[model samples]
Target: MHVQGVDGAEESNDGSFVDLRRSQAGAFTRTQAMRCGISDKVLGRGVRARQLQRIHPGVYVDFTGPLPWETRVWCALLACGPGTALTGPTALRKYGVDGDWRDDRIHLAVPHTRRLDRKSSVVVSRHRDLPAILHRTRRPLTVRIEVALLLTAGAHRDVSRRAAVLLDACRQRRTTPHRILAELPALPSLAGRSTLRRILADASDGVQSFLEHAYLRRVERAHGLPHARRQVRATTEQGVVYRDTEYEPYGVIVELDGQAGHADSISRWRDMTRDNAAATSGKVTLRFGYQLVSDPCSAAIQVAAALQHRGWPGRPRRCSPACRL
Candidate 1:
């Protein structure tokens, strides 16, 4: 005979706990064994068949058949006892991590002090309460991977914070360049603080972040475009001088016009001489400088005409108004 508090909520037949598992449903009191038509003996029988998975001491699922990974996370959470959340990789996948969410075993948050029995499918990690910087909703999306990143970000500085700030902001905003200032944990290290400031200042609201916004801004400007940063390397041609923006895409070799590259002639000469040696063969070259791209229209028009000349598609998307292509 189960000595239990008789919760008055209506229970469905076959003892399937209905009010549980829904994100926002719960009754304050217990259920009566007699009212639910479930006896202690019958409850024990269901528990053994791998049907009713017990989440914790009190809660049990009267499983009809199989459960999904996310459902397993919820059930594991229920079994792991109270005050638990499925925060981190679990949350991030829902937020936008861009991969298969079901591939991971469900992650659950127990107290920092609790020792959970590890199972094959479930991976457990200890966590203190989330920092004041990280807020929570009724969302169980944090998942295990990102929560670990946030923990590393707390230490501040190093590649992790640089990587974390960008990643966390992306997760939080579903976009890049989230206001990283508010979320910075209080870090006392001077280098760490300075790094945080640099990282935040550099964060971009652009369509992309990993592309280095400042560098892209420089490239996108209506001014002296340099070699397409990492993509193309340039050198001075003995017979011809071309602007950095001008590229022969087929044989990609950039032309470095040192005279107008920067005001510092001595430093400019040094850079150009080095660039000349670097562009041997086997590389596409882009050649452009201050004056060529200073007028944005000139640069775009030149590029389009050149690409079309090279049989690249220069035509705009042609669509009748009715079709909306």
Candidate 2:
């Protein structure tokens, strides 16, 4: 990307602004910086004038960068090499995986065979399929995990939502099968794949993903209403309905509202039509989004009510206004 000079002034030919303006082959290393005659004083000037922003060791970005923090993110990936990607939470933030959630680190995943240096802000890792996640977007290419997940999107919204949470959890370093399973209900309308089940199985322990599996599990999975099948195929007049969750003979369908359901025009229409069809049937469907699954109380209340309507008892009653936490 081109550089923006002081107050939108055109760039000067002087060597001083050259480093800050040029397209980098990769993340700048200490050795390269020293060779190019970059000093702490010059870096300080760049920072003051907003010409450059530092990220992970010697990596820096020019004010004229293409994407926000793009330079540093690319730098981390290039410096780490071909097998590396800005995975987990770093990828989530970079790719807008979760809107408005500020993360504190640059998570880089390398091949298990690669070695890394001790660097703050850059959390390097390894994976057998690190290359699977990176993709080129806009002018510069970006490494994305979700793109890989979307490669085969047949699992439905519930699966995708869980995968996003699972991705977040892996980014946050909170990886566990049970926890990932717990977080799954919160991601509404998210398409899923068998790949997601594999991703959950391979969660990391010390490295951050993008979510908190512990929180999701304790609140959702542990006390969640039981359903025999996570995804059930129901052949109704509405064509073919892929039910991610079911309340059995009572016909309680819990749909996970995902990004596509809310964002994509076709998906939204399909969802609306499906909901209308569901209502026409004897089925009672309670739809929950990311927030409801995160808490599950609203979902629980609705599920319990549906069950009660079908003669199931001993369920927790709704909390009184004063007793609400």
Best by TM-score: 1
Residue 320 of model 2 has an lDDT of 40
List, residue by residue over 69-188, the lDDT tens digit for candidate 1: 556666666556566666545555545555323437665556678877766566666655433323355454243333433433444444533544454455355544333454444223
Q: Write the per-residue lDDT of candidate 2 for residues 1-325, one digit (tens) a residue.
A: 3323322322334343344345553244444454555566766676677666665566666553454465566676656655566655566565555433344656676776888886756777555554544565532334444442332122235553544555553454433454544534433433553556555653432212222232134223444444334446667676897754566766666666645468878888877777777778777776766665455555566666777787665454334443222
RMSD to the true structure for each prediction, in A, is 17.5, 11.4
lDDT of 2 at 229: 41
Candidate 1: stretches off by over 4 Å: 1-16, 21-40, 48-59, 96-103, 131-136, 139-181, 186-202, 205-325
Candidate 2 segments whose C-alpha is farther than 4 A from its true place? 1-70, 74-88, 91-101, 108-164, 167-228, 236-239, 256-268, 289-298, 311-325
Global lDDT of each model? 0.44, 0.52
